[model samples]
Target: MTSLRFTSRTTSDGVVERDFTVGEVPGVLWSPAAGPDHAPVVLMGHGGGLHKKTPAQRARAVDTVTRWGFHVVAIDAPGHGERPLSAEDEQVRDEFKQAMKTGDIERFRKVSVGYALSLAERAVPEWQRTLDAVQELPEIGTEAPIGYGGGISLGTAIGIPLVAADSRISAAIFGGGFFAYEEELAAARHITVPVLFLLPWDDQYVDRQDGLELFDAFASKEKTLHANPGDHRTIRWHGVDDGFLARHLG
Candidate 1:
């Protein structure tokens, strides 16, 4: 099992942010400046083309730490953020850009799906290893409950598989923005933990029915679907049961 190596630390607004690495994977942990040991931990995933600490993600992480008093952790996905992008990753990205420039929707979908799956394949184990390191910390020992605090799109794509494979995760929050691939649906089928699925009623690239289908695929007997009218970027989440994770984790 790999251990976390603290690389930097900063504090603001009663939240302490620590940058760390689990072997080669760079990640950030946000926690309340003052909190009990073994508090619940939420593993947050960023959207496609975004890094671990984007403004939106940081705000959400801070809220999770301050509002729920739970620790929040996020990591750079493969070839994203501070991680070095491989030549193959660069080529796939170039193909993706060309497809978008040429108005090739099918090519764009194909390229995006392939790239997302590849990233997810590398990320799931990275997350598990990260969990292993996080549990070793005295403040968030092995007994701390875990939840997937989703970022939609690429986040949901990777999180579906992570929650399915890791029994340590007690609950999850997922949203729709990216295409729902078959493998994602398959992964959702294995998840029996409580779930909250957020759907953008209208998305520019992904079909709304696909999101519905992905929600339907979840085997969780306790699952809720919340929909709002807008695309992923413009959607405002309202009336969500923010206590869902706290209830399950505690």
Candidate 2:
């Protein structure tokens, strides 16, 4: 386990938001100022182009701590957030934007998946290292149950592999991501834990069939797919039941 250093601030709502470094990775941990001695922890991942402190991430963190009574943690994916982008990363980003602007679905799909897969490869290992570091924190508790939750392209790309590899993660809320790469689909087969998969019926980036195929690939005996009518970004904020997480993970 890598060593961790933490810096925290108290929100007006009384949640403690701690920023920490686990080796070279930057992450945030959120918890209620007062909670159970050993609250379960949820490891969250942000969408592509977004960082750990994005509005959605912050809202989910606060909701989980105050409403769900769980601690929340999130890390910046490689070349994202505080991490500087490499030349190759910049090129990929430019190409993806161009593809989107030109309405080149094929080009967009190819480049987007490639970019997501590359990030996933690096992000999963960092998440594991982060788990190692966070589990050692006295406030987090070593034996508490851990759940993985995140969405969109990068979050799903990285999270599928992380959940497949880590037995400590007992449940997951997978949203806004699809089976963009073979490795991500393959990883799903190993994820037998309970999963709540959210699908955006009108998602622009992901084909509905592809999302269904990915959901079916999960080895989990208990998995639920909640598909709502909306595009990718809209689905992120709507048409999802919050209580599902508490029910499955609690």
Candidate 3:
């Protein structure tokens, strides 16, 4: 696999930031330049505890999505970057981290699910911000089939925290986002949209079976799940079997 080199060229070169409003919650947008008018809009987030746009995902935004004629936007989730994690949230996270470090997988799962759900409930501002992030795209307003999505681990974990009722994202692709089955089914009961999911075997981040179980809930006929070899990060960059990606994304 080739390691990506960041130059003052295409990848980060196309990057630009702007602010937009979603209801009352304001959000910042990072739009990377794609060739021209692409149909479905793809939104992205960096891994948890990271900035909005990590180099790897950002590189994929340009190399994979932008090159494929899909407009890409990556944003820092609430409490990430300039956003501040609440004191309660920080304490919870610290305690949760201790549990995980102790190799208590069951406890980790339980705490994570509860934490994520609580976070989502408390994320009224973040939801509005997500809506605003899309509304304030570089291309601005354009009625189109929106593809809301993200990557492995927390980046693309589940669409629950990222989506609001007003969101019009039609086609979403979750690449290696290890979705928890019960959590996804719970959050996606009302979500009726075409979603595309790619899960990798041996991915330690998110459970594979769980991801598939979640994907199965999509009422839309267009939703699908693909399981293959390669770790979480590899399937993302190194020769992403984009053969299926191009068709679904378009």
Per-candidate TM-score against the hidden true structure: 0.97, 0.93, 0.73
Runs of candidate 3 with Cα error greater than 4 angstroms are: 1-40, 68-70, 122-127, 133-138, 161-167, 175-183, 205-207, 230-250
Better of 1 and 3 by lDDT: 1
Off by over 4 Å in 2: 177-179, 236-239
Model 1: lDDT of residue 59: 91
- RMSD, each candidate, Å? 1.0, 1.7, 6.9
Best-to-worst order by TM-score is 1, 2, 3
Write candidate 2's Cα lDDT for 1-250 as tens digits.
6967886666658688889999889999898888776688899988888999998789888988899788899999999999999898999999999998999988988898888888988888899889888888887767778988887667888899899988989999886555456888899999999888888888867778888888888999999898888777776455567876677667
Candidate 1 — which pairs collide?
A: none
Assess the local accuracy of residue 70 in candidate 1 as a C-alpha lDDT between 0 and 100.
97
What are the lDDT figures for the candidates, one per model? 0.94, 0.84, 0.57
Better of 1 and 2 by TM-score: 1
Off by over 4 Å in 1: none
Query: Model 1: per-residue lDDT, tens digit, 14-35?
Result: 9999999999999999999997
